[model samples]
Target: MGELIRLEAGVEHTSWNSSRTKMAAGMSDGSVHIYEPLKGTNSDYSCSNRWKAHEVAVAKLVWAPSEYGDVIACCSKDGTMSIWEEIEDAEKRDVWQLCARFADTKAPVLDLQFANCASGLKLVAAGADAHLRVYEATDVLELKHWQLQAEFANAADVREKLERVSCTDASVCWRPATDPIQQQVFVVGFQTDSPQHSIAKVWEFGEAHQRWHLVAELSSPEHDYGRINHVSWAPNIGRPYELIAVSSSNSLSIWSMDIPSGPGQRPAVKLLGYFTDHQPGEVVQAEWDMSGMTLASAGADGVVRLWQSNLKGRWEEKSRVVGS
Candidate 1:
């Protein structure tokens, strides 16, 4: 409803984290602004500690696991990521402590995410250069620190078919909010070519085999072209398994991984529910609660919406943050 914090050089992108104590805002001038939203009033939205986070436009912001506390990772147009933390000790005041910083490639980074799935949770990030990188984070001396992790090379065959595919990075998300589901599968969406359209892939990792295997592919059924903006897995409650939901340019679709049909045993994706507010033009962001029971959505219309289901197990608009 009001301005939380205005960047002196203007802002580029912003993300709300699962941890209510933190916020990551990217600036147009290649820096990231970090803040702790104060509870209680008109002045609360403001970020308490603001600083220069990058050398180029910070294109994406992602907060690490809450278990890690105060760690945020940011991607930049310059092909670098900065993971930082706020030092709240009396000696540091409001300054930030740099946990990690490095350049993986020269490709512009677009999005970042952490996987909560089984075989140990992993942190994943993608950039404009068509690189999907995964990191195996370790908790040392009770401090959670992320390393080079691992990098998934570009799909060479897929890149050759599309112009600049190697430079275009994809977005990542995991299926199932429950600890049970998270430990089983990892999902990611890519901006691919026509006919190929966009793709959502599910991967399963074997701890004993020390290998990550491809489980399923959620591709465009009718070759309809809509770039996936984000993907989420609804919390499995009262239900048997997890439900995957993906948001695109103009539509939102939900699929049930529990129900299998046909020979391939592919999951069924139903148009469970969707709403398009013409005024917004586009749906930009979305997320589920920690339990995956509730969903929140935001669009260009500047309205924040929450969706829940009725007794019939159908999704419905439950609440909204309007005109903010």
Candidate 2:
């Protein structure tokens, strides 16, 4: 029941704008294609433009909110991250231009996400260096100017010196902002060969200290769920605590974290639910619905499964969609 658009180049990653009026696809040949709906057509899309984005394969593409004015950030296999913006030309047509490029990373940038919060616009990038780097933009119009705010390993203990572990991949999800008084927080999951270091960690930006701090670790010693492949923070509309879903090699776990009400109070994290039976192979991705009431996960078995909580607050399988 879905419409398809054929492209000359093979796409490796695709992202849609927040307004849903446009879409961008990253090609396997390190190029990016921009498409928009054709005029007076319902399902037809035309490629508006194309550009070479990176020297290596483009791994990910994410668009900023409309308030940011048609901006996108891309991560590549060449250990570089770039931000591009669409500016109107003299003829009133849009032109895509590179706003900034960051190439200081030692390894490939696996994942990057943008968070437009009350604090400001922030970008978090995870790479093979075993570090989650944060960047902040003071002015919204100046998308090119960004300051490196913080860099830390995905671990609960920040003071201790942790050796650099080879991170094969990582996922970063920003906490949905509901309360203005709540501190800014995001979750990072590291996929590494090191069993002791492979885990999910929640990081919070401390306003008082002007730095970032690791708040909670979302794992237990009793069950070692191998390298995490995906993580998604649900949008909490009325829940007292924040909910996050993380997927490992074969299992998916949902965790609830309570925000501290006062100073010097640490956040408490508890495993709310977990799933392993529904998926026959490794779970590659997990996403939460808009209301945070439902979860959907895709596995290597080529199937999509949905999960929801019952009246008793126990999570159960809701439905399944098989893939060809």
Candidate 3:
């Protein structure tokens, strides 16, 4: 066994950039380090630029899509979410700099997303207290809008009578592939420390007020998968793009929307796939490539596995790279 020469220490989390040009890592010491990997070499092309991004440990990091340029979104234990974009020097090389600090809440924001922008452009966060707050990102000083999405708090829901299950472990909200209604869709997982089933909810824009409404709820019949981990979009997004999600378990479940056509077309979601292979407790993260044809997953067991469906349309394991 040889050493992992390329390893960077102190990082509590990492998020890959959409362009694949750079990636950001959040350190336990409250710093954010952005690294650009060199092509055809195991070594990075340049020195990592580290900055004090948070007052306490950086809890989660997510890179904005390339359409958003150098911007990155991060949530920290200090109870804030910040968006940073590079300020380039005269020579045009990136000199990473702070773009904007969005908002500070009373509780730590564990997970957040920026996918609603194509419609109304908003920022959403799931805090430790188990509330999902959605905010409009704009030049206006005051928060344009905010709503506590859920609260499953109670004595029975509390594990130690202090922490409860309505608490969210992670969250992801994405726009549907199509824009028939001009409103975005959101999916979130809710967990309480109680004996009841944890819930994953679907939300859509309401008939009036431009407000969001809960449309669907997903719960295990046996009530097992302890915490909802992450929700994601299916690849090859088209009109009403397919949706997919995964949890603490090794399963990858897929869903899709059936938009009605012509004069009357009510929408519906089809369960596309539920894939499970990695050993329990061995899997960590899952992502679909832009095409939705391939999936990448990695976890605690130290393996990065790639999966794909052939032209014939049967899914298969393509490759597995050992993680350092």
Record all residue pairs in model 3 with backbone atoms less than 3 Å apart, i.e. clashing: 165-191, 165-192, 165-193, 166-192, 177-241, 178-240, 235-292, 236-291, 260-265
Candidate 2 residue-wise lDDT, 183-243, digit = tens? 7788888888876567788888888898888788898766768889999999998888888
Q: Which lDDT value does model 3 have at 189? A: 57
Which tens-of-lDDT digit does each residue in 1-324 have in candidate 3? 643234367778877776666667888888898777556766454445778888888888887655556667788877887777776789986666666664557567878876634543456777777556776655322232333333322222345346443464666666534543455666765444543334556666554655565555554453345555666655545534454555445555555555445322335655544555665653466777777777777756677778776777556679998855
Clashes of 1: 13
- Model 1, position 32, has a per-residue lDDT of 72
Q: TM-score-based ranking, best first? A: 2, 1, 3
Model 3 poorest ten-residue lDDT run: 148-157
Choose 1 or 2, whichever is better by TM-score: 2
In model 3, where do residues sit more than 4 Å from their true spots? 1-7, 37-43, 89-94, 139-168, 176-181, 190-197, 220-223, 237-241, 260-267, 299-324
Report the Cα lDDT for candidate 2: 0.85
The C-alpha lDDT values of all candidates are 0.63, 0.85, 0.61
Could you tell me every candidate's TM-score relative to the true structure? 0.76, 0.94, 0.74
